[model samples]
Target: MSTPLRLSTVILPVRRWHEGGRRSWERAEDLGFHAAYSYDHLSWRSFRDTTWFGAIPTLTAAATVTERLRLGTLVTSPNFRHPVTLAKELITLDDISGGRLTLGIGAGGSGFDATALGREAWTPRERADRFAEFVPLLDRLLTEDAVTHRGTHYSADEARNIPGCVQRPRLPFAVAATGPRGMRLAAEYGQAWVTTGDPRLSEAGTPRQSRDAIRDQIERLGKACADLGRDPDTLDKVLLTGFTPDKNDPLRSVDAFVDFAGRHAELGITEIVVHEPVPGTVFAADESVYERIATEALPRLG
Candidate 1:
């Protein structure tokens, strides 16, 4: 039997009242959201000048505020963090959240995060190599008592973890991967795999185009899992839906939202993460859109 469809919302921690962000997480939990996530960027695109909070601390606060809502980053990269330090932080967070933390990791992307740290920009291949090493090392750091690894991008010297994660073996890893190399990492190490679809096919196209890209990616992931002799059913599939209500939004109507979710659910998406509206927008000020989703969209998804 397949897992039921789950819903998640991305809450970008950029509100004037940081406490308001906590309230947003609480609201999501109350609204029956499966997970509440924020982006793991030092500064996000276009909102680079805005008041942004670190993903770890924001998630920590969300954990403290909400009893049951799972908290995580939409996708965390190793652009600025070392495995040794990251393992400790994640383990502590998992403990605090009572083992309801999901680590969504991706290959480091080039842009503000790279330059902000005064690090040289690396090629795509180099980034993948780094991630290939990073995930396994971090996995060991979390599951093992002591780990010593020396790699090209990072090194851990007799790193010791005291009181490892509350989740036995380690917390769940929800790895984001849209490429073959990254998919292999996801199959090897991830408890779940997430995809936002191919930008080339969907960025300038219609909602149908976006769904098509996601379908292709999902098929590719299934093949990747099979190639590794891994059961695809073991990995939960998450689709990051890029729909934020605005004028001419494709998923504007309640019916549209339900249909859109159903299409993805049919494609084997266990979880769909819709991007939260920007603060001060009509959609953000009033959460009728989300409320309708809870009522009309969620039940039909299963």
Candidate 2:
């Protein structure tokens, strides 16, 4: 099978700058990115160096401004909103994008994401277990008729989606996962699996480890599928990572990108959602990042 082309996006993570939101998204599409993504964070844990983009509104702005680029959340917490309401919002965005929408979800295992929203941080295992039940509930609501039942921590009665999603019934739903349960949930119920690297973050000489991690995740996902009697080869697995564009030389920079691309691709990464930070915020957040991405990077890589 052919590997899908890789591309990136600038994050507008829970801060407010509508102009920046519009510009970055427009620029991403004009510069040939595949999508624009945002994160869900009600408030920053530390105010030391902070930025927050009210995710939904910022993404609505992105959807309005850009014509072709798909928009998505890195991941949204399932506990924070009723599945019915969240499904409505997603379907609304689907209409806005004319079907170019990707939905990513998980229990969101971090305190930074959870505690800030007045929710408790789930133990990794609990998040995994919760995911096992969570994925089925969403699947039934989005695809079947009259989903009604209860699970360990959630319940719904005939909560079928209204207006129905305009995207194909099997829309590109994804799950954010880094370990076993998340991986398997993605395999069974997702159009794609999306996750950033480990919480420790990336460093020099560690691409190989990241590669190993993904391979293991994919293998686990495959096993999870097999146990369920589901075919494993058909799933689209993706990684959410930052793409670093270097200015000094195209060869080295593009090589770095390909290595970045290949490391994940080798382990069944069907797509890459580049989390290239916006200028003036964090790493690679400068004109140089955009310049290298535009002038030096795309030409060599694509």
Candidate 3:
């Protein structure tokens, strides 16, 4: 049988926990979202000067207020994070959330995060190379009681994560990728594969073109899994909306979302993650319509 469609959301960490941040998390759980993620960045585009908080701490706090809501980073990267330190924190988060943490990882882009650490930004090839080393080392760090490894980019010196993750081998990894090497890593290490349509087509492409792009991506991901002697069916396909040409159309109304989601679902997307409406930002939308899509549209899909 095909995997059932699941609805999730991304809540930007643009508010203080006291000033409505905590409530957004609670509301997501109350709305019955399967998972709620926040961007893992020192700061993001446009909102760079706003009240951005640390993704780890924001998630840690969310874990306390939520019971069933799975918490995660939309996509964490090696831009400013070290595997050893990240593994230790993830273990704690898993225990706190009762095994509800999904680690969304990626080869980070050349955004503000690239230069925030006082170093030159890595080239595309360099980013891919570093990611190749980062994921495996992180895998070992999370599963093993202690690890010592020296790689081209990162190293762990007998780093220990005793009483490891509550999720047995480790928490699930939702790897975000659109390239070959990255897809291979996803097939090798990810529980799910994530995409945001195609960046190249985001500007001029129509919704149909975006759908076709994602369809092609999913096919490539399957081939990558096959080459690695893994079952592609075992990996969930996640679509993080808003980057597509259709942008916020899916959140405009319950019917619009159901229609938008249905088309993607037909293309083997198992999970659809939308952004929670933010009033004054690019992600802004009608709050009631967003809620209706969650409370009403999802059930219709089922």
- Output the number of the lDDT-best candidate: 3
lDDT, residue 294, candidate 1: 57
Put down candidate 3 lDDT per residue, 1-302, tens digits, no spaces. Answer: 98999999999999889999999999999999999999999999989988899999999999999999999999999999999999999999999899999999999999999999899999999999999999999999999999999898998898999999999789999999999999999999999999999998888999999999999999999999999999999999999999999988888888889999999999999999999998898899999988888788867987
Candidate 2 TM-score versus the reference: 0.83
lDDT value, residue 214 of candidate 2: 62
What candidate 3 gets wrong by more than 4 Å, as runs, is none
For every candidate structure, what is the RMSD over all alpha carbons to the true structure, in angstroms?
Answer: 2.4, 3.7, 0.7
Q: Model 1, residue 48: displacement in angstroms? A: 0.4
In order, the Cα lDDT scores of the candidates are 0.82, 0.65, 0.94
lDDT (0-100) at residue 91 of candidate 3? Answer: 95
Give the Å error, residue 134, model 1.
0.5
Best by TM-score: 3
Looking at candidate 2, the ten consecutive residues that score lowest on lDDT are 243-252
